[model samples]
Target: MLRLPKYLWFVRMKVNKIVELKTLYSFEAPVFDAHGTAGTSQSAELKNKLDLNSYLAPFPGETYLVKVSGESMINEGIYDGDILVVNKRDRPVDGKVVIASLNGEMAVKTYRDIHGVIYLFSANDKFLPIEIKPFWEFEIQGVVKHVIHAV
Candidate 1:
């Protein structure tokens, strides 16, 4: 996980929506300290401050974004138009959702370990679990930590 300080910021020139920011720039904002209902007005003791950057920031070069493109992971809440937060800096973990390039095709699947054998399982049962054979051009691109739905 990356942590960005409040003294500096970055700028993104978005044509439509917020894309992956690769550079840093100066940023300023008015941080609120009240924990109110999202759609309603409330008061607080001014003990908390909120910032979107705290949730997603300090994105390293290896921690990039990718847009999903299939229905294989629909059951897991990942859709075709969703943007995935992929962190290549971290090693792939068993039983975690990962972005992998299998035979030159990129796909998001659950990395499973069954008796020390690794396999990729699609959330949709229509697909079958793929064993990590010796002949495949398989590579773990990154581990998906966050997903942003387009809808």
Candidate 2:
């Protein structure tokens, strides 16, 4: 579900030689009715509020939501279960946090390139740097915009 702005996704997919591009989608709020419970007033309010989507819209140029699935970014305060906001439309630049595809595997990391050598960096020490040599296959997916941790 990790999403990037349209521009970012386009650039990455192009650079990575991805052959498919899926239609864009949005996130909808789920109903929390507490089914089987005695109907409560709170349920009505929850439904009403959830029905509104105006507040869920992102600012201009932002798109896509992906859930964090690992602890490799914990040192950067991005823990497992966090939701990542990706800007697919943004241009990838040095030092940007990006979602990368390596040999078809996906990862979220800080990207840095030095004289054509790409390095994937993780804030957590448990995860080591991933080097993208000229002979390796990889693609940048998108730039990370924000990380939302659910309390």
lDDT of 1 by residue, 1-151 (tens): 2222222111110112224545464344455566756666676454544554435545556667777666777778887668877778778888888877665556688899888888888777666677777666778877888888856
Model 2: weakest 10-residue lDDT segment is 10-19
Which residues of candidate 2, in runs, are more than 4 Å off? 1-62
| Candidate topping lDDT | 1
Name the best candidate (by TM-score). Answer: 1
Please list the residue runs of candidate 1 whose C-alpha ends up more than 4 Å from where it truly belongs after superposition: 1-21, 26-47
Model 2 scores a C-alpha lDDT of 0.61
lDDT of 2 by residue, 6-98 (tens): 433222211212222233564467655454457654443345334222333244345566666666777777776676666677767888888
Report the error of model 1 at residue 71, Å. 1.0
Q: How well does candidate 2 score on lDDT at residue 61?
A: 40
Clashing pairs in 1: 9-25, 10-25
